[model samples]
Target: MNTREFKDMDLSAYFIGPKGENADIFKELTEKLINEHIGYRQNFNAEDANSISEFEKTTPEFTNAVTNMKETLNELSRKMRSGSIPWTTAGRYLAHMDNETLMPAILAYNYAILWNGNGVAWAGSPVSTLMEEEVGQDLAHLNGYNENGWGYVATDGTIANISALWMTRNVASIPFAVKAVCPELVSDKSDWELQNLSIKECLDLLDKTGDKKNEVKAQSARSGKNLQKLGKWLVPSTMHYSWQKALDITGIGEDNLVVLPVDEHYRVDTKKLEEIIQENADNHIPILGVVAVVGSTEEGAVDHVDKFVEIRDKFREQGVDFAIHVDAAYGGYGRTVYLDENNNFIPYKDLKDTFKEYDIFTENNQFLKEDVYNAYKAIGNTDSCTIDPHKVGYIPYNAGGLAIADTRMKDTLTYYAPYAFQEGVAVPASIGQFTLEGSKATGSAAAVWTVDRMIPLNISGYGRLIARTLFAARKFHDFFNGQKFEVNGKTIISYTVYDPDYNMIDWVYKEEGNNSLKSMNDLTQAFSAYTSSAKGGNLYNLDIITSDSNFSPATYGDAPVKFIESLGISGDEYYKEDKLQILRASTMSPWVYDEKSFNYWAPRIKKAIQGKLELISTNENIL
Candidate 1:
């Protein structure tokens, strides 16, 4: 108690609940956790009708993903209470399925309609494929794609990103196809022609030319009549390492990815992006596309989607054929309901009302200056994008998603069944075609459908709930901004302010405002990420609780929007940030609402940070 230099952490009662048997304690607890914690879920607030009450009546039969896993854990907990089943290996004693930690996944299994096939088709349970289609639709709509279109929900963001890269490569070939082919005519013997004729053949023609970049360039102008055009993709430096991974995955050289620097806010530097495009093309590399972010994991920053779109259009006039892919895997669900419904984000010029249109009414429903912010749905206007329901969507784990803005882009990523095999198929992008993945997550599809059913994708509902989390983020940010804690910590960016050009908070050192505030954040985070007994959770991301309302994403959507808008994002370009390690107080859990529960559980986090800091501050035996 004497060494507790960080005073802003008054969460003394948090880890332990108030001493009472009242059921109200639990309800209050859920609210505080929902609004205050910032770890998981679509958000603290419910965003729609279905969202409000997906499970109104929990069967003593367990509802939560973690709860289901704990059914076995509870048995062990009971055994532990009885001193029977001792802690064995955090180990092989459990299997992936029968393992004690399979609860949340099991919860998802029940909803999946239990399809075990590669999930490759209609025969695998027509219902299952139907659900997948619905899940894809939800993802597309949530990430700002057409509401009723074709997209895919896959195993992970890696696969999703890879798929987009595949589409990107195919589309890039369309404009460059002619120029890339003819130079290989010398090597275009019978064996080579038979082995490769399709785009893969053209790409392999890369090896045929042996000239590397020039062969690819010659392929661009195969007829040798004109200079070829191959463009670079401008991406935020804060983007996922996956963008680089895609370069390798699609045979696109790493050198072709034009990385743009970020401003203090972690958004792509617009001026730099324009400069890189013009510079690279001048150096003989046409800019291929722009891949903005919806939710970057490193800093949880949603890039300004609207701004990038403007840049995309301006560059396209030069015949740049710019494709935008939004990496929103961690933040796709930020805008659940469609409050800014008019889709004002399009045409790129009407982003001015972004703050007011998505603003949430505070205490008296009266709008506050602090209450205005940008929207996420408005920020992800990409040719394609990917999102994960497992992370922020509040669904159980493993339900990552991929959504493409242009419906036809799906065709570019597809594999034609030799025209002979798929002779009768109407759609070129069949379930099993085009994708790098073979078997997919059926349970994930079910989970997405079930959750979306609970929370309709309109703004008056789930969108409102999304807004609430923004409120919590701002509350947490404001709380730390003014307080001069004893520890040294820094600002961690999360949420979009809704303004196409503004809204993201910078995470690196901000020396101008307050010097003491920086040290406190540093001190707080130092201890927060430490491990005691060398066991338990680590503070890996900046933690902030939106409010109990954010936890209600499972309930009807109403209030999450205001909070979301305040973070300042739009549907065109996602704000991205570095993967700075920090503690995240997740309100995605419904356990953090009222004063009573706040008294019990909140303090543990504070204590944990303090205790870890103390451990680090002392050399012990060395001292």
Candidate 2:
């Protein structure tokens, strides 16, 4: 390693058990959990109660339960060990799901599950409620939120996304409702006035209209006018399927979803987004909201969030008002770029060393560009943001979160259950009154809190882990893109690794005199798609473990044709069966950055491609 380059990686913190004491930690957590359970049970005298343990001493049911549990546990262990998907930490395969997690998080989660704490309200689980609140505050701060901001954990990214949209939908409709019943409240108001009313103002207007909160909710449930008839939701083509579902659930029909085309880099085209917004306005359709993705699902592209903010502000200056929601489910925590050792945001000048440390500025200047930097920095200004701790946080599954820039956004959606919120407890202290989920797991909150405590959400912690993953991606890209094979000193095949926005690498074979495969249409007709085995036990059979992305006509609706044309290639004919299957590799595994591990795996990746090409060249009916 060159001394001139930056070096600040604390390699020990990268693993689950840095000191190799996983066994001791697991044992300690297990014992503590049992003791806590016993302590709770001891509240009622043992002599007065015939508990399960006592009954089990005399009955066969306890034995039966243990027997069944042991058998199931054994099978679970067997299946997990034999699975094709690489386990976390080994770092061979990466198509989502990182292989490393903090030991504290796991231990804390195990301890919490013993109590089965339901984070519905204070009365239900007081400890978990506090932990959940801390977790929310931590996430809010991590994702660029401030004192005025608020956030909560949900089941996953989809739920978090829908929850944000739900709030946006209801909040946006309040002004129109107020105007309809109490005309005086909005008679002389401008467009921004009608659209940008605070939740309290809208609620006060509803009260002035002689309507109860429940009555307003009831009317909304019964339906007044569909959101599609009201406005359009502008989204990019690279959007996750969750947005489509969000529309349906929010009563905004999917047809009203204005799909913006992606640029060559796969980021949303701001020019087209502006055009569509203006076009919709001219047609008397309001722009309901604009969703900017911080990490696109397929290509990991980060949209220019600052550009979205600028566009919104430009429209706002002209009396147009709309909300911007950033879906950062996959890349929310990547904002670690802004934080320093003390978790304070540093200026761009200071970020250069961080970039240099990961070697990110070498080829992909996109990551360090001003627009990209501002995009991440602008997260604090968005109306709402959806982030999943499971994806990049290395937390256990099913931990998605939604953060609102203003806590007032939650007021309109509040619902209090008579039994849930006990006496003497305030609404703000408990979350059941506002969240979409009712009976949520407190264990998830514990896991996030414990892990984040150990690995603070700063340059020295979460930032370090994420930097390694990104470095692995850069490394994999270099290796995959540099491959040109020869058998017996004769060049047989080469590859064209499609440029990715992040860690996802898509590559296609480049064959000599393959002019017939000039376009995706021609290639699909010639080569049959590769299919994986159904049973799954084999992972390393192919020197490289990769999946395929088939850009066929049926799947993309002519987008593939346009994409191929943009590549300076020609395919005169168009066929529904026209498919362009590209091999994909995701370097989400941080372990790949380890030189020894990467050196061992790099040649295998090449061998996999070379072996496939050799077979194709020699066989007659290989397709």
Candidate 3:
């Protein structure tokens, strides 16, 4: 994958069409799928009588049913076309964490659904189950995991996070279980020490049980008996809401979750985290794990994962440890930016040279800042991570993934469902037994597998696509920084909430002399109607489509305080209103970086903002 070869590649071939440009390509592929399905049916028992006889084909009842189905499908398609968001159009859709899915993924999903295979077990979906395994390995490798690691697809990142928490909870109890079941295995450790053993040490103790592993596992927290011994879980305030649900569902009450405040950049405060860990250790309070977010949902902040690894190692020297899990649902695939064609991580010093060689980031290298690069590099050292294919992998919905650094961690969450697997089948044949979901759809697996096969998960593949989005976000941030709008002789200033760590940029606006946070929130909220697809407004009357979010002291603690002051709002006003509103743009589309697209849309966006400001000035309720 040389720069010339990558530049020469046709990016349009990967997308169906913005306006049916690739309709013929899609039609041809669909015909092939239909023909293959017909061949499969014809090859099986060709001599047998037809399931639907020729006489039935002529019946008016059947004819009416087919006609009714066609009419219903047409009606549904009409409604969808009118109501749905135009996510496929790169220029219009800047909202949310969605964009155009890859053509191979769409086609593969359609092809796989003809069989409706269930990925729960090999007995039910032999071919697709194996494909799921391969997809797992692909994701594992994409996130810096090697042969010793193992991964699997889940329903979504919520499920993946919950499963990781479940595994951590159960694994944490293993040392205590071993102490009770086989005293000699953990004889050198006291009860207090057993409760505080690191995740790896606990897994090692389980391995020591060998023949009695199942019995020891039964005595662990999975049996719902030792839940109290599993200790507290720590996560940043920037963590996804799913972490709360994960804690709640896994029997680790939300009260036990310690939410650390983020720094000015919205990243977790490592100093506070270290202090908490040291305090917990001194008090003998067992700590189960710490979650680091690679891409947070609200601000798209990348936590200092490298700092986390260093903290863990620092405490490990003092005989204190906990598991580290990364919630990278939105930014996991960005790791490809640092990987070569062979999937090896590029050294930090050579990263610029590599990008130059690949003809990417040639104009601006700030997209790969030192902090962001090191954070991605440290992901391999974490115990586990949650990644979503639909978010960053450019695949269709219902595909989330989990990767564990060690394959042996699978033993902690294993179950037995006799009907799902055959007696002689081996490990992966019984994958359902180790998963949180049952009867998972093979379409998602097939879609992911197809995309990975067509587009490798390395620098030459996903890296190129992701790099463009990074550049787009940086440009958007730069475009809005210090921009001003004049209305009614009052100056309205525009500011990005923070420098983007990935592709999401949050923009805020406030009158130059106005220090009222509520007024700012109202103005920004009013402006959102223009850029959003809200009902009661003209859907097409927009310069761009963007999402909106709120930051407040309640959920984020003091994270918004500094940002609020920078916007000329006082701390008293911030606390009084309790919220700050901003427009969010997720520039996941690669086309946004093109010079023509940028030049065309950027001014329109500015015009739209100016129009909103003039409208607000005339409206008495807004000021």
| Highest lDDT against the true fold, candidate | 3
Question: lDDT for each of the candidates?
Answer: 0.47, 0.66, 0.84
Q: Model 2: per-residue lDDT, tens digit, 1-623?
A: 32321135444443554234456656766688788787887775766755456666667877888889999999999887566444453444544445556556666777787776687887778887777888888878876778767788789999988888888787777766555545676799865566655444555665665544445544432245434434678877778889999989888778878887767566888898888887866666777788999877666678999989888888777666678899999878878856875567778876776656544343343434566668888888788899888887877776888888777677667777789965346554687777889998888888888777667777666776776666666667667554666643444333433455455665555443333343332232122232132312264342334455565444344544554544444534335346656655556665565567678777765665566555544542322
Against the true structure, whose TM-score is highest?
A: 3
Error of 2 at 541 (Å): 6.7
Candidate order by decreasing lDDT: 3, 2, 1
Per-residue accuracy of model 3 over 272-306 as CA lDDT, tens digit each = 99999999989888788999998888788999999
Clashing pairs in 3: none
TM agreement with the true structure for every prediction = 0.60, 0.84, 0.96
Error of 2 at 35 (Å): 5.0
lDDT by residue for model 1 over 364-383, one digit each (tens)?
22212211124354444566
Error of 1 at 296 (Å): 2.1
| Evaluation by lDDT, superior candidate among 1 and 2 | 2
